[model samples]
Target: MNQGKTKKIVYKTVLHIVLIILSVTMLVPFLWMISSSLKTTQEMFASPPTWIPRYVAWENYTYMLQAAPWMRYFGNTFFISALTIAGQLITCSMAAYAFARLRFKGRNLIFLIYLGTMMIPFQVVMIPQFKIVKILGLVNTHWSLIVPGIFNAFGTFLLRQFFQTIPKELEEAAKIDGCGYPRIFWEIVIKNSKPAIITLVVFTFMNTWNDFQRPLIFLNDDSLWTLSMGLAKFQGTYVTQWNQMMAGALITMVPVLVLYIFAQKYFVQGIVMSGLKE
Candidate 1:
């Protein structure tokens, strides 16, 4: 091979080696979580540490299930996540559509102010938000969780950016066919925005499903606790059950993992498309 070709080969090989090392580093925690879940408490703390349990403790899963109302937590989380996803998709998309397609006064200013809300940390608004929820009589109810999450500044910004990329010709044509704003939105915008919609769905679902703080503040009822809250039961003041916690954590990860797996293709596309502008 020529010197240039040899140099390219060496560079590519070194790049691959570095990537492999980084990939393995990122995977270590996940792999260890799986391994720890299958181990007994004693085995988990064994000298030199064991990557694979000598004896797989299937009882860890059973113990985890018996320790808490995991099935109910799962149901509550799924229900909350579903409603949040639906609400965000509808509300954010409409807001985005208006900002993207419709001409109105102060549109850019309004959008900028709305987007500025994203910079405010949730901690700053936690107390006021709870008070508002209480005033609306939604405190200690699922609505408290679902309502606040439904309208997100980030989601609006994401969808708006994506909506701006759609060809104006499509909307104009739809109007020529006697389609009103609603019909055009449904047929022209939403129908063609699957990638962005699914991307938002995955984002909203993951956020709602993994949320711990909001539920912690709003939901005082044990029956309404999410998996993140339920996992706290594995932790004791004096001694934490490492194995059971790992098992419960693994269980909690299943839904998020399944969601990302199915939406993996559209998720990437949506993110990329949302960043593009006409």
Candidate 2:
């Protein structure tokens, strides 16, 4: 028994060591980015790249801020991301409810077709989506980004799986108490599905926030450009501002990081529970 206990202890210790190593490995790039953001161009490219900058270039951030209309870029990004999250929550939840609960003809077939859309890469649909948006005269507008991102197949699938795991007895009781489908959905299913909802919100926010290609294709005006677009153009025709670029990149990551930190518990729970139903 003592030998068996020792073996289990060794196994657990080894597992923890492996996980710590993997965590540090993944953090290396992020750590480097932070280091680079604080360094001058020369120090950033020094022969032996220093993790600690000899001379911290605080001006890099200030320069990056002055270099672009970051306020407008942030406003545009937030506007688009907020609307996309709202629209996805409403549309995806409704669709997922119908798919998970309602008995309708061709539901499974329709769901399968909808799920198949996830397999299609964004690159494949870019041209056609661009043409459609152009025809709608939404080119050079934020709506071009918001409208395309409003409904997501993965969000619907995730919510539907979570909704299915909800006990039907609570819904039945609500029905017997004269509660309608809308009431039951709002009070029962939605209230219990917080983790899944938060998970979808995080995913939608991250995708919309980081999305570069869609905005690039649809928006022609500089004022409509997002952080991604703004950062891409930070490079000069003759010179690349590596330090300033790294600073901007670091700042760009803050929103997503804060969001994940807050929603991490729910996100992990949602991912685990959603898979259990399938």
Candidate 3:
């Protein structure tokens, strides 16, 4: 008994040490980003990378705002992310529910086709997508970004898997009570699938928020540029302004970080729940 207790203690101690090391490794880059953002130009390029800046130059942030259309970028990013998430949630949830519970013709074959698209690289289709967007007169508009993301194959697949795990007895009970499909879906399935929905929201927000390629390809006007695109331009124009660049980068990450912190619990729970057998 004593030997077994000692072995368990040693195992826990080793596990704790490994976790601590991994945590520090993950945090180092972010800590460096924040530290460099607050440093002066000279301090940023000092012989050894400074773990902490000698002086915290708050002016770096103010200067970044003055140097670019930061406010416009922020607004554009928020608008795109909000619209994309709204469309994705509605469309993906409905599709997922139908695929999971409802019987329809060629259902498996249609789902297989949808899954097949996921294997196709985005690069292979970008030129074609651009041509289609231009033909629709949405090339320079936010609709270009919003429209493509609305019918996401991955979101549908994820939610379908989660919905399949839900007990059919609940749906049967709702049916007996004279509840329609929409009513049952909204009140029963969606309520129980909060974790999965939150997971989708977090993913959609992060992807749309940080995306640069789509904005660069679709938006030609500077005023319509998202934060990621604006930041890329800022980096190129102010190559020497490491401080300001870091500040802008940090500002860009704020919304995503805040969202992750809030939704992290549901994100983890959803992942675990999705993997378990019903």
Candidate 4:
């Protein structure tokens, strides 16, 4: 027993050391971004890359805000992300329920088709997707982002897997109490899938908020540009403005970081629950 305890302690010490190293590796870039954001333009490229600036140049953030229509970018990003999340939650949940609980013909075949779409690289579909958006007059509109994300095969598959693991008895009990399909789905299935939903919300928010390619292709007007697109322009125009770029980067990351801090518990729970088999 004593030997086993000693071995466990040794293992834990090694694990902690490894984790600390990995954490530092991941944190260094973020630290540099923040540190450089507070440094003068000259200090940003100073030899050895100063980890700390001699003076905290807070005006970099102000300069960035004034340099571009950052407030417009923020509004556009928030609008697009919110719409994407709302649409995905409603559509994916309904589709997942249909796959998980309802009996229908060609269910597995349809699901397989959906899964197959995931295998196809986004590049292959980019041109066709753009053409469709153009034809539909959704180009340069928020709908370009909101509509395409509404039907996510991955989100449907994920929620379906979770929904399938729920006990049939709970659903049957609801049915016996005169609950209809919609009522049972909302109360029994959805309530129990809170963690999974929160996971989807976080994922959808992050992806839509940071997405650049689609927006770049669709939104031509600067006024309609999201934060990601704006940042790309910021970097391209002011390549030497490292401080301003870092400030923009830091500002863009704030919402995601705040969200993760609050929803981290559900994120972990969702990951664990997703792995369970019925």
Candidate 5:
């Protein structure tokens, strides 16, 4: 038993070492960006490429703020992300509950077809989707982003797997107590699926938050632009403002980081449980 415990300790230690190395490898670029954000333009392109800037320019943050309407971009991003999360949670959960629990004609076949949409690349449908949104008069509006993102096939598939994992016994017990479909879904299934819901929330929120392509194509006005678009403004025809852009990039990364920090526990659980086939 002592020898087995020693081997387990060794394996765990080695795993931790590998993870730490990988984490540092991923963090190097972000650290470099932060360091570069604090350096002058001259210092940025200096010989030998200094990882640590000798002189930190705190004014870069102030300068980037003054140069662009970052606060407006932040507002747009926050609003879009919040709404996108709500929409996905509602629509995806409902669709998932139907797929996983409700019985109907061609239910499995319909779900399979619905799930197949995930196999289609976004680029293939981008133009047609834009046209549809255009016909709906949602182009250049935030609705273009929010509405499209809400009813994700992958989100439906994800939550459906989670919803299916729930025991049928619970539903039967609830039905005997005079509960309805909607009531059981709300009180039993949804309440038990908090981890998966949180998982979807974190994912949908992050994807919507960082989404660059949809917003760029859908929005033309600067006032409605997201942080991704605002960051692009740092790149000029001739010169790219590396320092200011990095500062802004750092700022843009904060909310996602905070979100992960909050939802990280459920994040792993959701991923694992959603993959378990019944």
Candidate 6:
């Protein structure tokens, strides 16, 4: 109706076109991987390549399953991810509530010190953690993965920031009603913090599920290996099976893809805190 509105419409149309182009660009590799996995090895390396397979070699998936103990890898990964999620939910939430709501001596300094650990890469701490796990006789056990991953400073920090936004009045009201810290924490804080908790759950689960280095290093047994680790079987020092590798990769990506698809909304909504009012 107006020149300004016309300009806004034109801008949005241009932006949409740009986003569509970017989305297709991003999807090309994924589409190619799907294509390669369906085609035979020769078809994959054919001159000029082909987008569609002459024959959809569904056997590649069957071959992957028979070639490796993928089911065992999936089970092991799920167990590790589940346990890590539970442990992180308990440990991180409690630590976050303490830092955000509870009053104690040296609390701020202690929290700052802990939060600073986020800057330290796992590479720096891996040696000490490995030795600790070894000393505790957890080197080859699932605990080596679960226990070390439970106490993440980033998870604590994320929940702490979310916890701080909650109105102090609600906590005070609960306290005035003779509710104790644990009761208030469970009934009030946690009840109101779903978005943040879900966000943390998604992140922690994804990280623990997709982790390769920890499983590769801490686990010497093939049965305990995760899917990410199992994918290495498709690759060898001397030769690599490109088709099967693509097939294994697509299989490995399924859980992560499923997780994000379902949790995408809560993951985005949790961080914004739009529900909180002044």
Candidate No. with top TM-score: 1
Error of 6 at 266 (Å): 3.5
lDDT tens digits, residues 1-278, model 5?
99999999999999999999999999999999999999999998899999888998989999988888899999999999999999999999999999999999999999989878878998999999999999999999899999988888878888898898999999999999999999999999999998788888888877888999999899988899999888875565326778888998998889988877888886676567556633
The sequence of per-residue lDDT tens digits that candidate 2 reaches over residues 1-278 is 99999999999999999999999999998998899999988897798789999998999999888878888898889999999999999999999999998888999999999988988999999999999988998878999988888989888999998899999999999999999889988999999998789888887888889988888788988898898887776664316777888888987888888877888886676567556534
> Listing every candidate in turn, what is its Cα RMSD in Å to the true structure after a full C-alpha superposition?
2.1, 2.3, 2.5, 2.4, 2.7, 3.1
At residue 25, candidate 5 shows an lDDT of 100
Residue-level lDDT for 87 in candidate 5: 94
Off by over 4 Å in 2: 1-17, 236-238, 269-278
For candidate 4, write residues 141-210 as lDDT tens digits. 9898889978787788788988988899999999889999999999999999986888888877878998
> Clashing residue pairs, candidate 5?
none
Off by over 4 Å in 4: 1-11, 268-278
TM-score of each prediction: 0.93, 0.90, 0.91, 0.91, 0.89, 0.92
- Provide the lDDT at 275 for model 1: 58
Worst lDDT 10-window in candidate 2: 269-278
Report the lDDT of model 3 for residue 52: 77
Model 1 / residue 14 / CA error / Å = 2.1
What are the runs in model 5 whose C-alpha is more than 4 Å off?
Answer: 1-20, 270-278
The lDDT, on a scale of 0 to 1, for candidate 5 is 0.88
Higher-lDDT candidate of 2 and 3:
3
Q: Which parts of model 1 have CA positions greater than 4 angstroms off?
A: 236-238, 269-278
